[model samples]
Target chain A: MDIVILLYKGFTALDVVGPYEVLSRLPNAVVKFVAKQKGIIESEYSSMKMVATHTLEEIENADILMIPGSTTAFLNVVKDAETLHHVQRIDATTQWTISVCSGAVLLAAAGLLKGKAATTHWGLLDMLSKFGANPVAERYIQHGKIITAAGVSAGIDMALYLTKAVAGEAYAKMVQLIIEYYPEPPINISDFSAVPKEVEEAARAFFKKEMMKMNIAAAAMN
Target chain B: MDIVILLYKGFTALDVVGPYEVLSRLPNAVVKFVAKQKGIIESEYSSMKMVATHTLEEIENADILMIPGSTTAFLNVVKDAETLHHVQRIDATTQWTISVCSGAVLLAAAGLLKGKAATTHWGLLDMLSKFGANPVAERYIQHGKIITAAGVSAGIDMALYLTKAVAGEAYAKMVQLIIEYYPEPPINISDFSAVPKEVEEAARAFFKKEMMKMNIAAAAMN
Candidate 1:
């Protein structure tokens, strides 16, 4: 299976790597990181670099077309017509079209999620409506072949679901065992609304500062 | 804070990326990917290449020194004198020395886990005792300045625990929310032994075949 993961500058590492780590383990799975151009792609943090092995134009088809979201860079990619055209082209041949976090935004922007229910990162969940996509508050929602996960870490769960679909219950269990996917989070968050206002505000401010820092860095690079 | 992540050939991607995605969000965190020599570090699966920004010789100290594990390659790294020497040197300066999966094997091999209770991948848990470290079946165990997490996915939980320690509860909660870390696994395995015998065997065989394939590719490269 040719699993093509679309990459772009300033993409979030875990958004891609979370699912890549799981999906890459499937039997006979050939994973490719495809970008606008094949070369080094630095993450939004600018601390890690992953090599994109293929270009968007080079990978004509894929069994799985994965779109990973970024912190703020997703906004730019959503507005880029050429990237969306490539996404549409790749989706035409995919057995499964997957999105993680704000990646659903890209899919919605490409007109694939029009009138369909999808989900993304909590912060950007409502933003899907702007693209004619109904944002669901679930972990993931599948509309035929397109599966959209909630956010960054949710991709792992989404990929496991995909694995069971393609592989088997037994095989998926084995893969889960191999990764030791038993999650024991030290803290529990039952409700996001219940979180302290100060904490939520601080989190928002932190991301805003980070996006500004990344923008400054990107501007410097240009 | 200088957060140094040691990278090497044949290491598992998620074992490192899981913790990295969480820890990199810590306030004022400076994350660096270091290898024996600074360049492209191919994962065990050979599907991805992560650039190691710094060389082992160049980094003098780190506030948090993270050691990620590999599959069969951990055995080779555990036996490498120079690598162990570098790990020891780095550990001497770290406020927290952390390991994920068989990464504990590397820490134990470096004598950092001597007579200490630690955790690693379930498949390799017993091997820790051989290095004079007690192997616990828990998700993670912390001893003074050292923390060892159970398998690949467990590192995400372990890192959250560390995030709380460094940045406090509210900040860690913010990080968790940013990552949307509310996990909902599609399936659950309450007991490893209860899994069908065939499924367990298949998983083991799959890993063995993959390791051999990697060995063959490594030989070809040589």
Candidate 2:
């Protein structure tokens, strides 16, 4: 399997790293870190730098194309018309196209999620509809060739699901065991419904302001 | 807080990346990747390269020290007397020392886990005792200043737990929500006890052989 992962400045490190951890383990799988140019790339939050393996022009064949979200000034790079055009072109030829967290917004901008059910980082869900996608506030949403994972860490689930689909159950299970991904969270507040009223309200308010700013910026890009 | 993460060739990428995703998010945290030298570090399984930020000689004033495991031939690098001696010296001054997966074995070899309850990747738990640690096969184990996570992905849980301890519950919860760490496995086969007998046996056989080889290598190094 030939996998191409999009790497942009300020990209959320985990959104890509979590899935990369799983997908790169597949037998005979070739994972490439694809960016505009091959060199050092900075993470969205941390000052950490990751090296890209291939430039976008170097990628001619890909079974799966993944885009991971970023924060801070990195998000602006995704809004660039030239970059979105490139993503749209590559995604058009890929067998499976996936996005993690707010990366779904970029997919939507590329017209990949139009009229399709998709999801993103919780606070960023509403913007999906603006790009003609039906936003689903779920951990992961699979619509035919497009797979979108909610928020940052949900990329692991999407990767596992894709691994099972592409490599079979036995292979997926083996990888899962290696990762030891049996989650037992100390708090049961994974969803808004399960969280305290105050916590929920605070989260909602924080997202409301942030999402509005992102929406405005996304619109200006258009 | 100043954090130094050990970056060795053949180290498991997620073992470091998972915790990095969490700990780097802390408001005042300064995370540095410390290696024998600064350059591309290879992952154990995927053979992917991760860039290291600093050299061991440059490491000083670390509040937390983390060791991540790998399965590459590069394991020979850590076996050097100078490297192990440096690890022992720095570990003595760190406030909190931690390891993920087989990394705990390195800590134990350095005499850091002596008389401490620790854990490692389930497949290699039995070997922890060889390094003088009371090996506990839990997903995440914490005995005083030493914290060890099981296998590869459990580092995420351990990182969250550490975040809660240092930054408080509210901050940790906020980070969790941002990452959307609500795990829902499609299959119930994460634990050895939960998996089918055949699958479990197959995994044990595969890992046992690898562990034996690692044991011999580790013994020679010590």
Candidate 3:
């Protein structure tokens, strides 16, 4: 299996790695980190550097095409005609097309999520409707081969489900067993609804400020 | 704070990344991926390439030194004189010395876990005893400044707790909310003990075979 994960700055690193951990272990799996230009891409919140081993021009197709979510970077990618066009081109031939968290927003921006039941990060779930996507609050919603997962940490569960779909339940369960997919969160933070009102407000504020900054940066570059 | 995460070939990716999503958000946080060599190091299990931007020679001290775990890779690192020496040297100056999963095994191997209560991946919890470390099968056990978490996915929770220790409860909770860390595992995978006996047997068997392969590879190299 050839798993090609899209890499871009400002993406949530966990979204890429979570699914990568589960799917890269598939039999004869060869995972590649692909980006517009090769080199390192920084994670949004953490600013951790992840190297993109392949450029978009080098690899034209994927058995699985994964799009990881970002805070504001998703908007930049979606607005770019060439990148969005490339994503659409890949999705045309992909066996499985999936997006995690805000990545669904990008997928939706590419006209892929139109009329599809999809999900993204809880804080931004409502935004999906703007792009003609039916946003559900589930951890994952698999609407006919286009699997969309709810925010950051939800990607793991979504990947295991995808694994079951691709490689059977027994193999997926064994992979789960090996990784010991047990989670013990320090708080009861299941989704945006479960968080305090102040937290929700802060998240909204963060997103608004980030979007403004990204706009400024994009304008300055142009 | 300067947080240096030790990178090596065969280290578990999520074990390093999960906590990174939380800790890198700490106040004035500077995260660095450091290895013996300054370049890409593959995550042992999945072969995902993570770049090590800093070399062990370039960094002498860290406020927080993190050791991520592996399967048999931890054993190879434990036996490596220079790497163990560098870890011990760095630990001597660390305010917080921590490990995730089998990473604790590396700490124990370096004599840092001697007489210290720590934890590791649940299935291999007992293995810590050979190095004179008190293994506690909890999500994370913080004995003074030495903190260790149970298994792969447990690192995130441990880091949240670490954030509380380093910053405070409010800030930690805020970070938690930002990440939207509401985990919903498909299985009741709390720990090794919580798993069925057959699952444990299968895990053990899998580990045994991997070890055999690793040993064979080592012998072939010799």
Which pairs of residues collide in model 1?
none
Off by over 4 Å in 3: A45-47, A216-222, B45-47, B216-222
Residues A81-188 of candidate 1 have per-residue lDDT tens digits of: 999999999999999999999899999999999999899887777779989998998888899999999879999999999999999888888988888887887778
| Candidate 3 residue B25 C-alpha distance from true site, Å | 0.6
Model 2: per-residue Cα lDDT over B1-222, one tens digit each: 888898877777788888888888776789898888897776665435677889888876588898887643324643667767767877877878888888888888788888999998776677678778898889888998889988888888888888888888877777677678777766667466776666666566555555567664433322
Tens digits of per-residue lDDT, candidate 1, B1-222, equal 999999999888999889999999988899999989998889887768899999999999999999999777887897799989999999999999999998999999999998999999877787898899988898899999999999899999999999999989988888888888878888777546556788777767766765576563322111
lDDT of each: 0.88, 0.78, 0.82
Lowest summed lDDT across 10 adjacent residues in model 2 chain B is found at B213-222
Candidate DockQ scores, in order: 0.65, 0.53, 0.56
Interface RMSD of each: 1.6, 1.9, 2.1
Better of 1 and 2 by TM-score: 1
Give model 3's DockQ, 2 decimals: 0.56
**What's the CA error at residue B96 for candidate 2, in Å?**
1.5
User: Model 2, stretches more than 4 Å misplaced?
Assistant: A200-222, B45-47, B72-78, B204-222
| TM-score-sorted candidate list, best first | 1, 3, 2
User: For residue B188, what is the lDDT in candidate 2?
Assistant: 65
